[model samples]
Target: MASTEFDFIIVGGGLSGLVLATRLTEDPDIKVLVIEAGNDLTSDPRVNVPAMWPQLQGTTSDWSFKTVPQKGMGGRMLEVPQGRMLGGSAALNGLNFVVSSKDNIDAWGADLGNGPGWNWEGLSKAFRKAYSLTTSGNIEKEGPVQVTIPEEDTKWPQVWRETFAGLEYDPTGNDDPFSGKNLGAVMRTRSFAGNAYFAQARSRSNLTLWTTTVVEKLVLEPSSTRVTATGVQYTKDSSETKTVNAGREVILTAGTFGSPKLLELSGIGEADLLKSLNIEPVIDNPHVGENLQNHPVCVLSFETDPANEEGFETLDKLTRQDPATLAAAMDAYSQKQRGPLSKTNCNAMAHVPLPGISTEEGKADLARLLNSTSTAAEKGKTPSAFAKKHEAFVHSILTNPRKASDGPDGRFAPPPSVSGDSGGHFTIGVMLSHPLSRGSCHLANTRGELAIDPNHLGHSLDVEILARHVQFLESVLVKSEPLASHIKTKRCAPRPEMGISDANEAKRFVRETAIGASHYTGTCSMMPRELGGVVDPALRVYGCGNLRVCDASIIPLMPRGNPMATVYGVAERAAEIIIAGL
Candidate 1:
């Protein structure tokens, strides 16, 4: 086993880890070492091509985690496929380069008071600093991460514009929502985050990118104050275990599940759980594995009368029904990188407020339900011990604060998966972006994977929001013109077989159908300690000196859109903070 020391050691070479390493190495005087559990994806086409994103999950590239059976999702064990490689999930992610909403971004300061730097102005600059926009089909000279909004050559783009107009929702024409525009039906901007952030840094001699290295535990020593993270114990290529020391600092960018699991293994979690599991504790931090959050999305299905180029009929059905057709598509893709396989159907989307979409009575009922549960504990309530511990979590989410985007915390976007890999359906999703439900990520042993309890839809408030969103979509999608002329009136999950009619039935339908958006955040949250925050506003773990987390795990709340853009902006801010100290 070879042991090498560095000024800085970053665990997990995913989106945040790569971004931080690239930024830190800019100094050249400082050396950075990155340890990734998965192999480098430098030459993998599945990790590069945006259209192949759906096929990546559960493959060697993904740490295909399965959550404990969730009551909210009808006792189903949903898959949690996190990236395990260099460049990480950033390479395998749904390729939307959306920067979230203005109000949503502002909430980092306005609601949670995460500080001025986390606000939209600061994050917006970071977003700009991270990418160069592109449209032309060029890769060699453009950004390492190219956020592209292709030219209006496709028929679906115009159809979507007219359809949104027909619905009277303003289409924010070419304004680039990344600039702060939150409302409006906007087309997506795509990027491969891993390449955009890490490719250029590959040649830097000061940076050592180590792949297939699993961090076994964090090496820490008790100081007069906080426990100092000295270095780490890791193994490369399975059997060859090695120990490396960090002279300056140890940063945890291993993402939500990884960061928390590492913390638990290193004896920095709730003392009770630690004791129960026979692990000694250095810190009895009750918040380490709590406040796990995700966007529970409900997929809505439709049959397109005249399909787009990347529609299901040309992609899924062709490949499924005929081998010759699949061969032809492969040939076309290989020849010019142009074919139905080169794109996906989820290029356009919309966000709506609860009142704007739901019936007045339904809205009233939702408010009443939230208020009832949100009321002060009764004198004799005797709630569950966990509920008592997370009272702050419940109160904080009632405001849906960090997700304080203009809407009623609802987002609808297209995902390629439901667009049918074998038939005549194109699917869109209605996601409760700021769900009130909470879960946890714990560890049994160092070798066992994280015991995840995403507890999806555990809170009834999310069910109301999802049901209303679906009801609104059902009312508008096929009944109206433009989109009406295109989509056939049908349901996929909440189909006629599901018997979904009343509010209760709809809620039940949601329980059985909702799937994760995979945007996990808040395990090592950045709120006050009482509110179950694992890290301080500065992204430092509460009692770990010289140790900080610069990943999605520190996000107190999931943004009102996909969390990827927000992750990039946050990482940029983190780099700035880390550099200032140096």
Candidate 2:
């Protein structure tokens, strides 16, 4: 059995949790314990293999959460799959490495409530501290994660860049997207945290990782004036519960949904809600489970022209589980770690503003959207200080010329469809970077059951913004050459008969088909307490001295891309902050 005490007890062996464990235990005397809810599948082929990520879904490795029916999404319950294994979502994510733009990251300090050292300059250093970028265009030797633009087996990514360039979009040139401009066709990256960060540090004697162990709650020291977390109570394999002591501090890195749910369960949420549930209230912070934000994406798929089969080699056959193709892919990966089975389908992507944000008419339209039916009014309440600050940030991004919305940040060249009958096709994922809508995740009962409500497209402006981006994809992006030459006029989604010819039809289509990107954040916001903050700039929970949150939950503003890179930067910087205090 692992020791019952450590210098630090991390309450989730996910991506951030493991990063913290690895960095903190660099000192032989600093002991760390990571408690995870799932088993250690480090050696699982389904995890190590790149193309096999789709197979991990719905298996024991996935949390497989379903949001409450979102009225804005035609009353549909979207699937939010989180990783339940030791690597967390990194083990199950699509493996597209993208960093946020400087404008968006800087907004966290200038527009939002975050103070100094949270801007792009500060976070970008932390970003490079976690991952080494080694493509033909850019190369950095530092960091544990090996991020690279793989040599693809298809000509689609080149064709994708050329096509976008024809439409007046600039290629990233020699610059990787890390410079923060991020407005061109930069090749998406292939990287994972399981082997890069965790594997190297797991053998450390001072670092203890307990898989299949569920953290029930944080052990709080009772005090009327201040809140302090001293340890955690957890269970292993449905066995009897046990408590572990934290010698210095207790950190919550259980991700967006898990972190806030843990907070509420540990008597640290809204006072009235805890009292009604017959649980003792340690700290009365209503924002612990509020400010939930997620990137909503609508995938537009096109039927690939059968005649262009030579230049447009996609994973259509493999995705359909064709016996021969699967066997060939398995043999190639098992033998040489090269071939179609080695990388994810995503290769080419761009972060652009709403179709015509530079024009005067575009500014007027956005201003009208911002002023009409404010965030609090739409939710049938008065706006809080934080809500207003959030609104201003949205306004700034929408109106700014330099900042792009990550509309269709990702466009996949290979066939992503899993339908048994799904033939050759190309797909583009249109994503809203900074959504104005905010929902929440809270405890459903005293048993620690959760009620997750993403409220996708809850704000009326979200529908308008995302619909405009979708229309741009069908009308302009798909119509361009090089890419258009390969795809047929007929589309798999938004079929020819669907009549998505205008903005109204596009809005309806968005409402019917959009789903969450699973890049959940902002539940435990980092800001001043008066601005509805759960944790302060130092990442310490308000009214608590030793308790802190270091994960996606503490992101006050949503970053512009896949959020994997941003998470790593935040975790790397957090480790430094924790170590400095020690």
Candidate 3:
């Protein structure tokens, strides 16, 4: 409350917030303020080091929000960990700098009516402007984020690419994931916002960042035509409550769960639900917290032969805490900033079209499944404009020969365990890129607690597609050469004795073991207001004049591969949009 006013007030000082602040403050005349709910752990090794990401969850940095029991997963609660620091979830995510497919982004403009700027051609430039590739002999030292594919000494990547190539898929189709498609066992980058965006601009005089401050609600001014956001009411240090005003606009980067929860808390949600919570109603939009989506992943772990260090020397050695290996890795990292510790063991991955889509039998099965699901939706009265449009977008990708619907990512490391029994493992995680299932997030009460229901695997279509992907892996990919020669016949995750007999067994396996990719989006989607969209093409909230959401929550559809690069690209593009308006 130093000046009691600023050009812009950002609710969350996470990834997008920092990017906007850094870019906006480039003009020395403009000032920006960022309020973060969690403290700045920029100096902590858990945030800086690439390998220590798994330990950040359940710590002070993670929000650690648990979803309501998912009926799709047999009434089990899944932990949805969101980063709560200055860098946000980017500080606590698996370092995979992947971009969305071109076809997926193109649909946002063509099918979804998001207009021209939201299309692939427009977004691709934004993606390039955000981060520069810093690989061997191809260094770009300009962009804010330094993205690098850590050099690997093992042959895991070669075997991984060759395995998929053996199945008649091109292993180099997506050598440059920035080209819009992520369809190959290419090595993605390991970069985070902490070491890049925030670190570069933290010392700016025009930018003020307040950590450990929670935003209560937006300060809105009501008029006959529209609602205007002037500022925000917040509690700092869990003590005195205060209000601040914004001179220009107020942006909500509170993330997927937090963004919608704040909107609902501030009375910008369904009128009945707001009134039920003893809160005054401002907007009657019921879609404020709807359209929640996530990429549900089914993991398949296999035991690898450890005798060949050329192919099997993975981070599993680090997981097992081998003293000699640990010492060597530390020495290499500290001395040259290169080693197994420099990046994750999940270096090889592929985003492929639905498994078996080339065969006539597979085409028939897919057609029958799609028709049945469509009929079910019609009978259940679930055919909203948004629903129909989304189904069509997914349909285009699933049936197209070039578009990808399933992502199979390979990890050379074993799952972490405290018993010290995890070792010599290779895991293939098949993630459903475009899930047909939809969910919601809302405030539980007036005091401000969120009831998040990701509703993962709620739709049978998601289950069916994921099951087929798993079946394809066990029957086709793992049995091929190079990769097959490096692994044993035993399974590490689902015991060796647990053999699948048919598609029914695969579906059951998916229902039991599927977990969220932690890439939650679409709570506050960007589409037409009539189509239950919370924001317009300009990313302005429908009923608010100066309020906008610039985080992952604004993503209309779940993108292929990881959403980290897309988030950065969106923020960069958003900064451009906001600046151009001025």
| TM-scores for candidates 1 onward, in order | 0.87, 0.94, 0.95
Pick by lDDT: which candidate is best?
A: 3
Which candidate, 2 or 3, has the higher TM-score?
3
For residue 151, give model 3's deviation from the true position in Å.
1.4
Over 4 Å off, model 2? 181-191, 380-383, 409-418, 494-496
Position 371, candidate 1: lDDT: 71
In order, what lDDT does every prediction score?
A: 0.69, 0.79, 0.81
Of 1 and 2, the candidate ahead on TM-score is 2
lDDT for each residue of candidate 2 in 1-582, tens digit (9 for 90 to 100): 544779999888888888888899999999998888988877787777777777889988888888998999988998888999887998788777777778667876545657667887777888888876666766787888877775666788788778878977777743555776442211222345667788888899999888889888889987767777889888888898888999999999899989998888889888988988888998888888888889899888887887888967777778777899889988887788776778777666776777778888988887787778577675522137777777777777878765677556433443344355555778888899889888888888988777888889988888888988888888888888888888875567644466676878988988988889988988898887777689887789988889889888988778877777788988998998899999
TM-score ranking from best to worst?
A: 3, 2, 1
Worst 10 residues of 2 by lDDT: 181-190
lDDT of model 3 at position 192: 60
Q: Model 1 over residues 1-582: C-alpha lDDT tens digits? A: 356779999999988898899999999999999989998776677765545666778888899998999988879999888888887777677666556666656654445656777777777877666665543444323225555553343455566667757866666555544755432211222245456678778799999988888999899898777688889999877776668999989999999899999999888998988887777898889888787888888776665654543432324454353678767767866787665545544555555555342346644665687676542442321124434434344334443422221222211222344533344544567777567677889996657467899889877667876786677667664466665665566654335466454677778878878888888987888766765678776788888868998888887766766677778877888888899989
Residue 485 CA error for candidate 2 (Å)? Answer: 1.2
What does the lDDT read for residue 489 in candidate 1? 64
- The number of the candidate with the highest TM-score is 3
Distance from true position, residue 244, model 2, in Å? 0.8
